[model samples]
Target: MAPDDIDATLGAAWHDDSPWDLLTRLCAFDDRLGGGPGERHAADLVADELDSLSLDPRIEPFGMQRWTRGHTAFSVHPSDERSREFEAVALPYSPAADLRAPLVDVGHGTPAEVEAAAVEGAIAVASTDSPAGERHTHRMEKLGHAVAAGARGFVFHNHVRGQLPPTGALQFGHEAPIPGVGVSHETGAWLREYAAEDEEASLRVDATTDDGESRNVVAKLGPESDAEVLVLAHYDSHDVGEGALDNGCGVAVALAATRLLTEFDLDSQVQVAAVGCEELGLLGSAALADSLDLDRVKAVVNVDGAGRFRNLRALTHTSEAMTAVAERVAEESGQPIATAEGPHPYSDHWPFLRRGIPALQLHSRTPGGGGEWDRGFTHTRADTRDKVDPRNLRTHAMLTALLVRDLSTTDPDRVDTDALRETLREAGAEPGMRAAEVWPPDWD
Candidate 1:
């Protein structure tokens, strides 16, 4: 992008409040779970915004077997005292189950630790985060390991406090073999204490499983070209909170950027895609990858971490073109944007990245940053409208507009298959992918 164009875009971005308005509209819905009404509303909002720009937007709907939450009961049965029950939520995709077994604390619940503890016939408990110097452990990995070891059930505790219980899916688009639930940080500590002495625990989870549908809003901009740049965000959020941070912020930022970029000329088209069902696993994007012509996609920039903070960073995933643009934009705009060269199969970008496409997962730079995986308040009940700042939205929209413009003109150095696999292996993504059953994408 030229300096003249950069200044022009910045001038337009300084006074923009449209992103905050879009975010407010998105936050009005309590939860945007995949295949739910909230997600459909969000998808329609994005399409309407794009239609206002004369960009012919389309909603691509897909179907899947969905999970509906019901009552979940968990209690500790000490021999000498009355049973104590705590508040918890059933993990999505957890099957209907009831069991009473010994509660075993498998700290971090890595595969090796779960095996060493001999937790067969017991309900294994694990933390949301990995140990110091260890890669972040996902809830699905912990749950999968427990079931593999013949554990009757699984309990995941949030690493963050303030009574927030982390909510994520058990298995990708399928009923998990055993029951799973999440508890607050403080409650998990109490459970560990109880495990040392009176370890008996009884758990019951009930739910209605059925078929459902979800939609993705997609719009095309700029003149037709051989390959296009994919700008992506997910409209679906977890059922636990308003989802302002995890993805509401992301979709809003993407809309604001698309609104401005409609007027700019580009060498290639930019496809704005608001996918659904990311929280239940990357179901929407996975479906898209299976259907779209991968050969015509030059790059993918997934907006997942913007608008919550002032500074933005990109997980470049070994894409040289992406890393260069991130650094160039920060230097040119005088913004403190950081770039990480590793890959983690956690967000909407994973589908494209795994297929040797140049992919970037853009997120807010973690404040007081130093390899902290959890960003305090996402995926919990506290992820509300008050947590986002309007100023951050405008700033990110300007920077993203510039990044997309640059990617449109520059050809990406696609990541090699073996090297990409090694990068994922080094970043500890293999275990989580294997657990979620989304690993070894068709490209492998």
Candidate 2:
């Protein structure tokens, strides 16, 4: 088929009002964790829609160690004997802890300060800023330092406007040893001042963990082929936000691309994965990565937080050859490609990268070096569909279709493993990890 013919078909499929309505309806379903109406309802609705497309959609069930917000309330007591004033909402996944211990003011929770302070069993109030460094890295390091210093809990003061605290699985790949939460800048500042003035500050957090099953919705186009291209997006959102730009937009692009691919018969196969529990330490992607036959997989193109902006940001841990391929596709599609260093831990692509598979995470750039839009709205209730740009969505879908079509048609055997190995070694992945592991039996 001609390129213009494909463009026309994709334009018609994506430009219509139906795609927007479908996106709106999907966004409306609350898919937050912990027995909320969103998760199951959204999965069911997506499954129904995929079936309507005459595609074989299946819900692959898996267990997730889930956390939910239990009864939680925090208050600040002033030294002048005024009644306690509640300062901030407890973050999701906060551990259950009750201590009236004296508060300590630690600026930025750095290693040196944490080592210097008497912080055992005390609520550590810290600023979320670095003197002169990468703010996200510095903040995460501070969090780790606080948890190590025997601090019972944390109160992070938001330094930037509209900033929300980090929540869910404290460490990216492991459980956090202590419960942590974020407070508004005003609350954090007051706590800091109260501590400095020798006034008492106290906080109590209540939370719970429930064992439950979450699912990865898989829709495959084409027959069982040895070589496959996997496309992914997370369907689950933070408890507070609707997850429109964070992922609802991504889901829309993936779904729209899948629909377009279905219209044409192809030599190779495409697997669309709508992952669950990505907000919780990339659980869904980890599960899917463990189950796949990596030897036969050609490449992984993850569409996360796409179609909401004009710029196209492509993060990859793939070979330069693969990067060149992606760059070529972006050039042809009239999109600028922003390349980043290997494997970002924030999205579903991390797990695949860990397993030595070539993977890419595609998203839009946030203004003023704020990282990404979802980072701004992460774990907050303000994330909604109104933030999405339909033009961005259409462009992402078009690019994805072109990339998948090209990769699927290309011979997997033609890929250069030696060059790929060198690339992985330079990227710090140990040799032999690129060899796909044995597929886990009984992928339940």
Candidate 3:
């Protein structure tokens, strides 16, 4: 595309002012956690917005073992007796354990290492590589493995270079068998060194779970359609943050897309899913995926971090045809689009990918610079609307609308998984996994 063409595309995006309105409306909900009233109210607001666009909304309900943090407290007592108390917060979904256990220094508690040490009834402290994409998943997995081997709880020390101390809620599977938390690099280093020197460290933790109703606010355009396209974004935020950028931006963009598509009156069927409780293990997405028929799904486009336009990254675990459609839309919108082959387990797309449905993840980044800033704001209180660039949000909304329109009208058989796989591998993904095995006589 010519420079003038690019400018025009961007200009067109900026001309539409719906994205800003949508952002303001969605942020009004203050939605957090999967099943809380905030989530339910947020869903209602999104559904109302879709209804105003002349779309009929559907609510698909499923039960999830919901979790919430309650009165978490942890502290370390020094053997010197004169040392001040070092404090820590317990991770979400951690089991309540009030025992004053003897602390054991387990270096990066991998499965094999934990087994070799036979750590039981002792708190394990390990160093984390860094807090970046998927690093938390690795740490949590290690913590779970250790808990299964009889460890009491786990603590993580930050290892990121020249970074601020790690803060915010430590989250894991709601059903995880053990408790976990993240600590400052300084504190973690102290614990490790103290253990190495044969000084005793004392640890304690407490937490609980409560029952609640989580919801997915869905709005549909076109009724009784054989093929459907689902557009998704989670409205929930982590404990300490307002979730303006982590997902509030994506939710706003999706809402804007819904408005544009409705105004255009496209023939294809579309659904906007403003999911709740995503931060708590993708509960809303998991429920929606299970409730829907995979065979009827034409495609899923998940919008996340869409309000920042400086750097754009679009990852897909969808068919080649869908990826092509995304690239074309990006081209037309005059946004730089980079593709990746991924079934990003952390996002709402995981449920669709597991069902063998085509899915995509869209994100924005800082221009030119690739540093901690691009990935750091999430889960922290720093994620707020001030970081949002309205121009970027508008571009994302336009691209999303175009992609959904095209996919909803296309045939599922035209999608090419093989080509998509090659594209993804070149983008840094391992070859796609073989289709998952199906079981149970009643499976869909």
Candidate 4:
């Protein structure tokens, strides 16, 4: 296709209504927890769309440790104590336990805080907020700290206001050492004050765990080449919300890009991979990465948190080559893109990045740096379709396609494995990776 044809195609996509329509359809489904029916539906939907595009999509099944939610309740102790029963949700992979122990408020639940506070035989109540200028603490880190401090139970308090209790895994590849529950910011404040006066709080969580199956939807377009540029997006979501802003919008963006990219002939093969079980960890992406020959992968453009904001941002995972390509693409496409240099293992791109593949994770840029953007609705029930801007979704999809095209033609000569490893170390991702059990044994 000519430059004019490419421009026209992108312009047409910018005005297209299909992306938003697809977003609505994806958010219409319930709780896309890994291996659950909702996630299977999402996988089938992506496959069907790819099949319609004649992409001959393949569904690759994988097994993951799954947890089924049961009763979770939080209440203050002391038979006559005056305290309201705060609504709470169990953190994924937390084990079943019914304990009535003294609550120890450990501030941010840092290792230092857990050590300083009286956590032995107590339920540690920790804030979700990271200290100013400090890296955000991973959920598993807090739980691990509490467990090390001999805490009998754990409660993670949201930093943002509103009754949204943030949800994420306490640990990956194994069950948590203690039962964990998430409570709202208000509840956290109450716990802080109550702990100052009283001693104990009661936490009851009952959940079941098992190994279950999930899938990744892999489709391809354009001519086959020795190297492929991966367009990664995850289709699975948490059971707490529709996961629209968190990822449903991202899935729609990937599909929309697929629609536009199929219109023009491409130099290298573009593989559109919509993986499942992201919420449980980057399991689907890991499975996909394990199946591929890493040398054949040129670069990865992962839309894990796309379409949430107007300006698009990419985490280059400390790859200067990938950063250069993204900047060039943004300039060529006339799309504003913010770039960050870091290794974030929480997203889907990490599985490939960990293996020396250059990858870019696309996420929305929040203005003014931080403070409850998206109304703190991520992983909560309020993270629905209304939170996603249709115009932003359309623009992101177009730019994503442009990036894929540019990256597919780019050689992987610039990838520096040594520098990438150094960057991950300098960025302080090593501790978190070890805590999350993603640290490669060979790296040590």
Candidate 5:
């Protein structure tokens, strides 16, 4: 493609409203929680959009243990027959529970912290935020630690102050042994003070688990060679919010990019997947990898963070070749794309990365401390359509389209397993992985 042609492509892309329009359509759903009605609607809508591009999209189905949220209640008791009730929401996969136990603070809820706190038979409370210089802790890992410590219940409170109670899964594809709930920062503060004075707590959670089906929306274009590029973004989000910023942005951006890429005749095939069940722990992408020929995949561009912020966070995942390409794209587009230097297993990219695939994790990197800003609103009820800027969506749609176009022939570096093991170990990810039961025995 000539400079003028490239210029024309990007220029037209800048004003495109397809991404923003798609974002609105996606956010219109009540919630895209794994197998919920909202998710089913969103999945069919995405397939219809893909079919419009003549890509012949298919819904690759998979079975999963679906979790449905139910009513939750929590209170502190200072005396018999009287209690102070607080608002809370059950974390996904929490088992039905009606329990009273001493509330204990397991600061940050790292395995060591929970174990050292000796929270046996107590209700362990942990913050979602980590102190500076400490590796970030995941909610599932905290619940794992709490369960292992013999806690009867778990409490995850947001560090960011919003009345919004945080919600995330307790585990992938299964129910937790104990109940877990999330509360707002204010409620958490009240709990800390009341736990000191009251000496007892009561938490009740009611939920249901059942077998269900989910899918990966797949489409392909360009040359039908043995090697191809995989462009992935999940359409599923948690039941707590509109999911606009959490993943609706990524899916919308992917759809928008697909619209633009269809106009160009490329040298390599691009397989687009708007996968499901990611919010429940990447089941769709895991199923996709298990059912496909990964050896035929040349590179992967997993978009989980594309449209939330203006500047794209083109995380190279320690691949020097991928990093070089990101820099080239940044320089050519006159846009600065920031990069991080390690592999992360928290998103759809991990299913591909586990097999040594070189993947670029595209996320929205905000101005200050990267993830803190993004997560301040993402997982909670505050992650509505207003948080997503239309300007950012269009810019990402164009840049990601350009990135996928370039990655078609970059011959990106493959991750080394030994290096991946060591890096994850040093980054304090192995313990959490093990806690969540996701650590492969072979990686050890």
Candidate 6:
């Protein structure tokens, strides 16, 4: 296609309504959890869209252990006659238990704090906010610390305001050992005050866990090639909020890019993956990675969190070649692209990255801060459709389309597992990886 023709196509991509329509439809479902009703609905819609483009998409089912949230409550006891109950939500994969124990508030709930507090046979209270100059502590890490300290239960207090209780997974690959719940910052403050006065708190959580199934949606654009560029985004989300920001935008961006790219022939194959079960874990992406012949995969562009801001940011982990490509695309498009140099194994791209495949994680830029950012809306009930803007969504899709076009022509240098491990150590990401128990056991 000529440069002028390419320009016209991209401009037309801005006016596309399929992406926004899909986003709205996805947000309407409440069961987007892996293998849940929402996931099935989302997969059907994506497959239908791909069929319209003659992509012949298929739904690949995978086994996953899923959980359902139930009743959870936290109460503070100043005395036998005085008690206060606060709003809370159970963390995913937390064991279903109804037990009461003394609560001890451990600020930020780091390993050291858990060690310092008398947490044996008690419920440990931890803040979700990380310390200054330190990385945000993973929910699993905090739960692990509490469990190691002999704590019978765990409670997470959000740092941001607005009565939003933060919820996240406390298990990595297995079910959590104890019950875990999240509370708002205001509730946390009450717990802290009671702790100062030498008071006790009680927590009771009743959740349900069972073996379940989920799937990954796969569609192909352009002709078959030896190497394909993998485009991935999760359609599953937490059950609390509409999940509009955590991943609804991600699906929209992927659809928009795929819709536009299908209009013209590409240099290589593009496998559009709308994965499921990311909220529980990267189950869908993991299944796809396990099934793929790695040699046939050239590069991966995983959009987990995009369209929340006007500009798109790429986290290029130890991939100098991909960094150069992103830079070139940014220059040519006259669009500012933010770049972060680090290794993060929490998203869908980690499975591919660990295997030495060059990958990019697309997300919106957050303010510079180790803590104190206004992220209370994430993982909470406040993440609604209003938070997403159409303009940002369209711009991000155009940028993604350009990236797909640019990355298809280049073959990335593969970094071996040892080199990848070394890169993580040098980047100071090893500790977090170890804490999350995602570090390759063989590497150690």
Tens digits of per-residue lDDT for model 1 on 1-444?
566775787787778888888899998986799888888898898899899889999989889778888899999998888999988889899889988999898999998888888689998989988888877777788887888889999999887778988888888777888988899999899899887774799999998679999988888999899999999999888898989998888988888889778867788989999999998888888888887899999899999988787788888988878899999988977888889887777888888888889998888865775354766788788889899989888888877887998899899987797888887777877876686676775535
Candidates 2 and 4, the one with greater lDDT? 4
Model 1 misplacement above 4 A: 1-6, 370-372, 441-444
lDDT of 2 by residue, 1-444 (tens): 676777778768655554466679877775555335687777777787788788778988787766766665666667577746654555545667775666788886766677788787777887766545332333345556776778887777766665454444454333356666777666676788777766655666777766777888888887678888889888787776677776778888888778778765567888888888777667788888888887777778888867767777777654464577677787787767677645434578766664556776777776567553235554556577877778777777777777778677764332344554455455433311211111112211
lDDT of 3 at 343: 43
TM-score of each: 0.96, 0.84, 0.80, 0.96, 0.97, 0.95
Residues 1-444, model 4: lDDT tens digits: 899999889879868898888777778887888888989998998899899899999999998988899999888865465756889999988899988888889998776788899888999999888777767667777887788779899899988888888888787655788899899998898899888876577788999889899999998888978988989899888888998987888998889989999987689999899998888888899999999887888888899777888888888877888888889988988788888876767889878887788888888855556732233578777788888889998898988888887877778554566777677788676665675677777676
Error of 6 at 1 (Å): 1.9
Model 4 ranges off by over 4 Å: 78-80, 371-375
TM match of model 3 to true structure:
0.80
lDDT, residue 224, candidate 4: 73
The parts of candidate 3 lying over 4 Å away from their true place are 1-18, 21-31, 81-83, 102-119, 126-137, 158-173, 198-206, 222-224, 265-267, 366-374, 412-444
Model 6 residue runs over 4 Å out of place are 366-376
Of the pair 2 and 4, which is ahead by TM-score?
4
Q: Candidates 2 and 6: which is better by lDDT? A: 6
Task: Compose the digit string of candidate 3's lDDT tens values, residues 346-406.
Answer: 5787677655677777777656654423455555446566777887788677777666776
Candidates in order: C-alpha RMSD to true structure: 1.6, 5.3, 5.4, 1.9, 1.5, 1.9
* Backbone Cα, N, C clashes tallied per candidate: 2, 6, 3, 1, 1, 1
| Residue-pair clash count for candidate 2 | 6
Q: In candidate 1, what residue range of length 10 has the lowest lDDT sum?
A: 365-374
Q: Which residue pairs show collisions in model 5?
A: 305-363
Error of 1 at 372 (Å): 4.3
